[model samples]
Target chain A: MKTETTIQGLTASLASARSSKKMIGFVPTMGNLHEGHLTLVRAAKKICDVVVVSIFVNPIQFGVGEDFDSYPRTLEQDSRLLAEVGCDIIFAPSVEQMYGTQPRLTNISVGQITDDLCGKSRPGHFDGVAVVVTKLFNIVQPDYAFFGQKDYQQLAVIRQLVQDLNIPLEVIGVPIVRAEDGLALSSRNGYLTPEQRAIAPKIYQLLKQAEQQLRQGEMLEQVLANISTELTQAGFVVDYVEARQTNLQPIAQFDQDLVLFVAAKLGSTRLIDNLQINFKT
Target chain B: MKTETTIQGLTASLASARSSKKMIGFVPTMGNLHEGHLTLVRAAKKICDVVVVSIFVNPIQFGVGEDFDSYPRTLEQDSRLLAEVGCDIIFAPSVEQMYGTQPRLTNISVGQITDDLCGKSRPGHFDGVAVVVTKLFNIVQPDYAFFGQKDYQQLAVIRQLVQDLNIPLEVIGVPIVRAEDGLALSSRNGYLTPEQRAIAPKIYQLLKQAEQQLRQGEMLEQVLANISTELTQAGFVVDYVEARQTNLQPIAQFDQDLVLFVAAKLGSTRLIDNLQINFKT
Candidate 1:
């Protein structure tokens, strides 16, 4: 396994790999690797000839009061985990390396989909995700770029971004890694206190209720209302509980590709989770 | 010369051409190929082994009220001219072929430079240009993409966009093709009446004067004031006459790499022109 800190080195390495006919699979993540990140690495190893993982916490995605300053950085542990997972190369570019200078006030915005769930609560969050993803894409130039379904809407936005921008890469979505108790895995889960951790699973439990309602042939409006009430009663501030069609258009009638999404605040930190409720067998 | 209407045909053709390890130079033009466009082809032919010219009047770059419907499109004449200029392949795609059904709304925007100048006058003009150029970049994936410096700010924006997005192509700005009397060659010149064509050189002349003033240690304010008076006296509606940094930043002093830009309404049509003036030169 090789590690490169400079953009030029990683880019040359990737280009060299390509000329030699090695398929590259990439997992771009902010540092502090957990079991969830390792799952992505292991998946990349299984398919691609060369598995490249990039660990850089993107600061542009964070708005004024967000956790950019306090976001965890565990590069040593993260590097150790990648080495264990048979990773081919790791690109760890510093802030200066990622952005030569502050990118002059530009943004990449997807329409109502970004405006609906995570976008509404975080404000400029998806745009930040977009610009950073574009930067990483330029750096990694991976054949198959992987994103865990954990950040489900982010995955959706990225899919649209690649498609809209005509980016020549396959956007592969890995299923959400979950705890035994069904809580979705996220790096931000570190911010939760022990007591808050206990209640975190309840948010997923409420989402499951919304999923169950859809399974039982309940209408989207009733399912959304039921989930909203459930989250409110659990002492979680429900930002929005929406059941929409696969393209994220509001459900006038249920389609087999409907997705139920939730975003709420636990203590001072906000977390989001989503499930595709109506998958056909 | 081979003419391809689809991306697959062009790619196959270009790839086969590339098997010989030849350097490809591409010129992207909205067809209605005049002597000006042929000049770019001649330049491309002089240096490159493969010269690919794209002829498609991009619809997205024009505003709703703008002259997309009225824009002159001369495909037949363009093909003959390209052939005469020793062009290798002509890649022309329909809007549907270039943009897929589920067009991704994620677009590339280059910042403040677009915000002022032409961007302010024609709303979403650069957004359209950025999006269409991005589509062309993806479709053609040219080794070298060429643009004329007649659209001066556009050259700067494309340079920034390609760099910012990490697009793998070289953006080459060819010097503007000028008429015998020094009017910048443009497709929009078709809109000019006979009398209108006679005085079109005034726009270029005013910009040159501003450049001379800045070179001789004059303030931008006084230079702009004179240009505005000149245009108004000539019966053109002066839209904006401002002196800005070469990067399109507003200037507080008469120093540094400077550009004097002007846009005005001549009858119902809008024309923009600029002069690159380096004060310290």
Candidate 2:
């Protein structure tokens, strides 16, 4: 895949691609690729004439004492994976490249949507995500941008951003890619100990079991309780396993459009997962 | 001009125009086209195959009592001028069309740049400007966007915005277009009473004198005092007239890259004007 480290070069490439009426599908990431990222790439490849994958561990997105320093930088392996997956361009830019000379302090604020769940655990995390995504969106200028549903709230927030700020591109969300035993795939999963890895799938197992129970008319609260019990039993510190409306509002009713979002810790790795349940009432 | 009142139609027309490598020069205005606007259109026509002018009197930018309701809007005259200037497209979307269903509350903060000048007088004015410009930038997705330098701080703010947000469009700041009497042309110039209109030329007259004095190695304090004296003598209320670095930083040096920004009140109407001054030691 052709690579560019400069904004001018990328714009030139995009201009040519745009001239040809080529639909560009962009997948922007922080560059510690796993199955989830590949799934997004594959989805982008299916729809767009050109696929661009940008790998920049944006320093602006990480708060103090956060993973900015050690968020994993496996660009070589990531490039190989993108090549294998048939990406047309890998825009692996350095910090300076993404943020040009005298890059002014810029950020995007996600309001109440960021006040709970992972946001409560990590202040300024959503803002960081919003800021970086906005930067990436401009740099790529894709016709359609792909993101994973694993970041469900992020997907919602981005959708809001596009609508609110009038961002031009379509944000296409790909389904989460999980392991065979139901563990959600994440680069951070690599940081887990062997014993932690062994028990990681239990989070998904609990979510699936809760999904089954809700299908049998179990109360939303009870299902959450069951999932919480399973995660605790599996030695995981549960963050939240709330059932919410598809729009991220916590709800009492487990309607057809309910989304079960979960975030928990197994060792130092913070893993998040979600399932959209569309069962008939 | 192919006029579109909906976002989708505008996008379709714009996309078609751009896909063929047509150089699109965009002029985003709040309607009520004056001589200043016509000058920008003329410039756009010279450089682009497609000239799309958007008339959005953005409500977001108008704080309470900020002339949003009284903002001059002459669509028929504006349309006539645009057609005369050979504009390819006119996107004059309605408020409902511009703001979709359930618009999210997202504020595009304008940071330190907004804290001085008009921003100080009108709190959140730059934020509104930032949000609306972002929206227009997304909708037009132009190769180049044009702005008149009469709004000196605005040009600087937009330049910084494109840099900070990494917006993928060339921001072209056109020189301030003015009336025959040296009054910088503005739609709001229409709001001035016949007497207010006659004396409105004082803003430009003061800046020109200040520019001449600065070029002759006059101290900045004396120059500002001269400007303030001349403006107050001309039956205009002086808001501020100060020299600053092109980026809006307060400068003590006359021999530097500088801008002389002036804001004044003619009767009850407010007017602003600016000029670039390169100082040599």
Among these predictions, the greatest TM-score belongs to 2
- The candidate scoring highest on lDDT is 2
lDDT of 1: 0.81
How would the docking of model 1 be graded?
Answer: medium
How would you encode candidate 2's per-residue C-alpha lDDT over A75-151 as one tens digit per residue? 88999999999998988888887776774655578787777877888888888788778888988888899988998
Which ten residues in a row are the worst by lDDT in model 1 chain B?
Answer: B246-255
Off by over 4 Å in 1: B16-22, B42-49, B209-220
DockQ of the candidate models in sequence? 0.57, 0.57
Question: Which tens-of-lDDT digit does each residue in A1-281 have in candidate 1?
Answer: 88999988997878767766678899999978888889988888888999989999888889889899999999899989999989999999998887777565456777767886878878888888898897788667787888888788888899998888777689988888878777788888899888778888887887787777678787778878888887777777888887777777776665567777888878877877888765676
Tens digit of per-residue lDDT, candidate 2, span B1-281:
88988889998888767667788889999999988888888888888889999998988788887788989888898999999989889999988887777856566776787788898888888887887888888888887889999987888888888888888788988888888899888888888888888888877777888888877778888988888888889887888877788888888554787888888887668899888887553
Q: What lDDT does model 2 reach? A: 0.84
Structure candidate 2, residue pairs in collision: none
